[model samples]
Target: MTQPDNTDDALIRLFNVSKRFGAKLALSNITMDIHKGEWLYVTGPSGAGKSTLLKLFYLGEKTTSGQVLVFGTNMNRLARREIPFLRRRFGIIFQDFKLIAHRNVFENVALVLEARGEPRAMIAKRTRNILRHAGMEMRMNAMPTTLSGGEQQRVAVARAIAGQPEVILADEPTGSLDPKSAEIIIGLLSAYHKRGATVLVATHDTELLARREGRIIRLEEGRLVSSEPAVGEAP
Candidate 1:
């Protein structure tokens, strides 16, 4: 494993974290640090615990033991009211896209701003800008079911980035798209990473894994099997 920098700058940290769902151990003792402004890939095969780890980061799932700290606060100890505040700092892209089936693209993305209590005018402005960035401007008023898989994923990306959060957590973002659409999704995430947002992606796609560059961590049966800097990024 690559030794995490022993500084006070990590954006996310896990210390001997473990999670269990009934009799099955979903994740074993895992210790890792995701630094600010870094791009990280969590890669593993099916049932290898990739999704579980990402869930832990966003507090969608809690650890059975040890601790998780985000933006310097121990999430395990955070009050329920505080979880939303912490989540606002993260943009999560789900494998299923997770869009509101009843809402139009514009309204879907606008919901992010709405949750934060932004005024109507600013929500309209930001939502339009981000949808444009994702190449979904023309589909602003279209419903999710009317769009193609790639288009829907683009909408999801737009929503994730609409808030310009400090961190982006994506799970199998391209798992369902064709090659070209997959490229577009990953490219968008890379653009954000280049602009200094911390990013963590979990996937098992080898081709997708080969095309990107970042910190690569592999998991096997819930164990941290490998951690290394991207090919050109090694110190």
Candidate 2:
């Protein structure tokens, strides 16, 4: 297996990290580094620990052994109260597009800025801009349940990016969308990555990987099998 990147300036680092659920070893001896302003793809079959890996970065799941460091702090030792602060530095997109059914698109997107205590006017302005970018401006007042799958995902994207986080962790972001919708989602992420945010996408879609250019890492049975640049790219 190829060695994981371990540069000094890594924004996120996983060192010999392992996670177990009961008797199942979900992730094994993983060591990887995510650098600032880089786009990374984590690819593997279902249950290969792709989602678990992303969760570990944001503290959704703890490692059974070893350490996960993000933004210079060891997550294994971070206080519960401090997790939220660290999460604020990350924008996470889930496969299910977990939007609140009762909240309108505008409210959903604005909640992030509101949580950060931004001025109401600023929140309104930024939320509107982000919705427009996600092509959800017209649906801003609509409930998430009222939107189509693609539309709802767009709203989720808007919500994820409203805070301008330093890192974006997307887990199977396009797994359920049509080709066109998936393209839009990938486009949004690509645009975000261009703005200097580090992006880590966990997907098993070969077509999606074929269409994007980034470093690719493959996992098999919880073990990292390869880490290499995209095809046609230089090492």
Candidate 3:
């Protein structure tokens, strides 16, 4: 976990990481390195700690024990103010879009830059750029409720990437989309990866993996089961 020079080689790393809720252990002794610009698949059965692992990276939940390092800094020792700064380096997309229903798509994405204290003009410019990338430019002024599930999710993706996070953590991003829609979302994530952003998608959908390929890390019973790199996939 303390790689020092090699730490920068990876955007995320976990060392002997573990988390627990009362007597239920969520993750047990997980240690690994996710290289910068690498696309990784976190595949597993339910209750396998995929979500828990992602949470540790984003500081969404505290690790009951062990070190969770992002960009080579140990989050366990990060001060409260430092935590926010660290989170800004990585965009996290939970299972739900977590959009503010009263807000429009533009506002949902703009909030990111706003929170970062970016000026209004800059926020507006970046907001529009990310929305276009997510193919939701036409829906900018629309409210979350006015859009379909796929559209709302697109808004979430736009918001997540609008800040230019070095890493993107997606938890079942395509879980709710229909077959065709799912393909489109995954493709968008792949596009980000191709652009040199480290991407980790926690999913159990074999169909998603079947369509494309990348490095795969399977977790079962809260343990890392396998790590395989998919090279020269037909897709």
Candidate 4:
């Protein structure tokens, strides 16, 4: 696949990319551009390589072939010491809601600021503000184990947005939530997108894919089969 011709404003680009796990090819010859401030959804059935695609963006897994550029820097060329810096520009939400088991809600969100060496006062203020906005403020002192799936996902979102990252990469963020919970999670991501952050969500949810605003890219057997505006959307 060839990349989009006009990528001057792209935030991430993948050129002739492929990924393999042992003998299985997870993604094959994927060339695409994720533009700045564009909301995108990577949709496919299970094992369609949606997760692998998102991982490549964050360098959680390197490509077996070709190049990936984020913010115009080649991911393959990024030094080991510089990986953290590259990641700081992204806020990732995992399907499992990877919060530290022992950390309270406040501590979990504050951890991002702490890693960036934010002052205690600043971390507290930022963490509290995001949590309050996420409707998790009342659970600030609660442990992950005590929260329901919905609450845990909310906390995970709070943590992701605490640093005001430039891009958000969410892998099945609402996979385990009820319909109402899913709405809340998507709404939060949408709010961030409206604020100028680029957002990409990998989901298999039919309802989510039906949303009319985002650009939807569908994958099948590791190949990009379609790229189109959401239903009822123009272009």
Q: Estimate each model's TM-score.
A: 0.97, 0.96, 0.93, 0.97
How far residue 133's Cα lies from its native spot in candidate 4, in Å, is 0.3
Residue 109 of model 2 has an lDDT of: 93
lDDT tens digits, residues 1-235, model 1?
A: 4345666879888888889999998899998898999888999888889999999987999999988888988978989999898889999998889999999999999999999999999999999999999999999999999999999999999999888899999999999999999999998998888989998999988897786678889999998999878778865
In candidate 3, which residue pairs get closer than 3 Å at backbone N, Cα or C atoms, i.e. clash? none
Of 2 and 3, the candidate ranking higher by TM-score = 2
Residue lDDT tens for model 2, 86-120: 88999999889999888899999999999999999
lDDT of 1: 0.90
Model 1: how far residue 83 lies from native, Å: 0.7
lDDT of each: 0.90, 0.91, 0.85, 0.91
Candidate 3 regions with alpha-carbon error over 4 angstroms: 1-8, 232-235
Error of 4 at 104 (Å): 0.4
Clashing pairs in 4: none
What local lDDT score does residue 23 receive in model 3, on the 0 to 100 scale?
91
